[model samples]
Target chain A: MDPGTVGKLIAFCNNGQMQVPAPEPATDPRRHAADTWVVIPLYNEISVIARVVGELAAYFDHIVCIDDGSADGSAASAEAAGARVLRHPINLGQGAALQTGFEYVVGRNEADYIVTFDADGQHRVEDALEMLDLAKSQDLAIVFGSRFLDDRTDPGWLKRVMLKTVVWVTNLTTGLRLTDAHNGLRVIRADAARAIHLEQDRMAHATEIVLKLGRTKLPWREYPVELLYTDYSRAKGQSVLNSVNILVDLLVR
Target chain B: MNVMWIQLLLVVGVITVGLFLARPTGGDSHLALRRLFMAAFVIVAILSILFPQWLSWLANLIGVGRGADLLLYALVLAFLVFVATTYRRNVATNRKLTLLARQITLAQAATEDSASIHRPHEGTSNDDAAH
Candidate 1:
């Protein structure tokens, strides 16, 4: 795929939904390890971290695993699987963990771009790579990974309803009409990552990032990515009640 | 004007208990202030109910028209104070949590560095994680 022609982005009004662009066609394996960094915030995912890190290590050399006080051996397994693991003594929520990773990359100038991937197997490595390619190709500051971009994953009826409500609320609050607002798979340019700050240490951080993006000069793109929702990940993922908590966190604090 | 000694005792007794319960719980000054504010509200309401004439006397001294009006003003002021203090406390707690997270992250980095130093060849197999 010609990187420049990928996505065919056209910004418009509320009536027009930004057609989520498809991922770029396969290219040479992205070997420039000095440019891209992947931040995976791991909790109690001992069974999954090793496989996740191993796969990420194949495509990108800089894999940063942030262990959020997992009582399981997630950190050890990730480290053994060739990941630069950073740990927290206690659980500080996903927002804080991602911020810590962002600071690590932005503060040290480690990579040109940073990708936030899930510790669980719900997110696909292909989508992350594609987003990274799109961001680099378009010179965009951020590229958000979306599931509903195409008929990729079946997230059930209840989850589908909850996702729409969240997207609507997030769009209203953040002032950005994003197709999928709370998806974890995000690829951010280095400068935007440096300027961006995720302060809400809970799920509210997702909304915080979107709001920050709205307030920034960074240009962003959203690409259609497939989210492989496994039964294990489904059982461990955020609930609809957590969406309420995120809303309250945004409003009250 | 009649002075009921039993009424005075009840007022004093309730105020004392309320003040004691409202005492600061050591470190969290905001909680202490919240309890104290609630106690103040309860005590004032009790005093005014017991002696309307006494409340009116205080109101007149303070240039207020009615004792009920004075009580209403006090309640409003207490409620505002509670809200303002709660907001400040929440901000402080958020800042504290950020600091704690940063410290923990630093500690983790330090441990990882030391482990690499001690065992250069083990390649992250220290068994010091997730017990």
Candidate 2:
């Protein structure tokens, strides 16, 4: 079978019943109109998180940070920078950390729209409001941020291919048709956020959520968002080889 | 002959004791009964092995020498069946508990997700829903 078709099948399987529209010309995030809360799940992001928090504070009304048992002062720094902070007793994986933030927001009845933002400073907070706008106009339940949109610049040859392959595979499993499937930045309605239960404890948890969301008949959209990788982000990250472990985990469970 | 009478009485006493100790705890009661039955069977086996002549004499006095051996075989088979059934039930219960735990965790995540999205914050500015 063609790789593209396989990817779509895989995505469809994972997404359950969610529908993705045919590809169209790229557009900016600012065109949507809903209220949004920026949620950043962090673990030892004390190095460059202040700027990420500041940028989000400038654009969104609510900023939530989950300190996933970081030994460093990442939680305090994020709290000091004005984000509502929640701390895990021990190091849960990023999925658990994101769940904690999602729970906190839902518990307080604070946000109608939720955006999962990375604390590593690779995401541009300025585009957050734009994504919010897009979500509102389209009445989308979930909006994934895409770095591989028609108008967006590709990060590099390696990253571009790697991300595209992941997107294709995810589409095959979940039935979601996204250009940048693994992009961490995503905006979702609070109801959809609550309905999609994620049990994955690590990075694979993101895939789990996307797959579950696709299974539901909820409405979703993919919008162009920017990724700015600095020296700091590259130094702290693991290679794409780690995806092997995620695949193994998914299969075993 | 006197010793043989005492042995017969001992076996009877053990059987009686086993039935008397059975409780009403449903599943465990049956398990306990099986264990007691096995223990009685072990005692009978040891007595027969130690004094085959006495059993033979007692079997004749009871007018059924072969019936005693058949009863012993029945007890052995019953013990084996009880052990197998217990093990199978335990394994089945463990699997059910695992599935239940997963459901509970997912339900918790679902509840948390809903609460965070709907609950309003007191101090936080209400950003308009992007549309």
Candidate 3:
């Protein structure tokens, strides 16, 4: 299927949903929201994590934040904002936090889907909700959010080049062609999430997750989603030089 | 200039070790092989120190110039092997640590979840009282 048409289709569906005025509770597309868990691997984002969790709590009934031993009270802030907080005693990498979240969600019998979100407030809740809807409607086991599907997200030229290189490397390793590899928004069904065993504990886990998920041979698709590259997120973004570390981590293992 | 036999041997040895490092390590057999290699190295080191002339004679047979040069080459190869083994060990250790930390975090979260479920209303009342 052509991604261009799919992108336009998504835009059209979004507009259709917006035009609806006071739909009945029975007709709400988000009726299954209770079965979806939003897993956020939070770090030292005390400033914005409360707002992020609060925004997610509006749509998702279950929001779990894995606090990787933040020096700041980010965990408490997330808890106050109505999220289930899991605290790691020591600071592990984001990948480790993600794995922990997956395991925690998978242990519960009620969870049917996991939406991996970022704590930096770059990801849009509407995008996550749409991805989850696409997954359910299409019977997809995974829905990856891609920024390059449209021109809405414009990371700087250098950052774009670096991200494209990462996409190339991820495709080479995972045997799955994806427009964006490092976006922190993904919708993984419970079955697909159970298959992921991420050994890479650092930034390399992004590629590792794709590699493991691809090995499952489950039905997957890329959904066009715009990432809000705010100043806070930009400041916390990965540096180009860090790609060397990611390469080494992936190769050595 | 013709390449000496020692140069060819060193190149082949380094290449073989590099390829070996790339392979997934076997558990018991790999440990046994490493121990055997260490034992052989110790014997050779003692022999070289005890009879320096014998070391030079052996080095000449291998086309190396002197006993010191042969020892230097061996030391460099041993250092590389040490680095490779240390790196592998570190990766394995990190994996174990990650699993342990995850277990602890999950257990704590589960306990807190049960506690809140049992006294669900008390938590909200405490929050309201604090506010």
Interface root-mean-square deviation (Å) of every model: 7.4, 12.8, 1.3
Sort every candidate by TM-score, greatest first: 3, 1, 2
- Give a tens-digit lDDT track for model 3, residues B10-92: 88878867776676756788788789989999999898789889888978888888889888998888888787877777777
Candidate 3 pairs with clashing backbones: none
Collision count for each candidate, in order: 0, 49, 0
Q: What's the lDDT for all of these models?
A: 0.77, 0.68, 0.86
Docking quality level of the chain pair in candidate 3: medium
Q: What is the per-residue lDDT of model 2 for residues A1-253, given as tens digits with 9 covering 90 to 100?
A: 5677566546644653323322222354332322567778889988888878877776566788877778889988998898877666667678777776776676657689999999999887655665665566557788787776654555677767766767677777787776766678988788888887676676777678789878777887776667877788777654678677667545444
DockQ of each: 0.23, 0.03, 0.62
- lDDT of candidate 1 over A48-102, digit per residue (tens): 8899998888889899988898998999999999998888777888888999888
lDDT of 3 by residue, A86-152 (tens): 9998988999999999999999867999999999999998888878777886688998988987789
TM of each candidate vs. truth: 0.74, 0.59, 0.88
Give each candidate's fraction of reference contacts reproduced: 0.45, 0.00, 0.72
TM-score of 3: 0.88
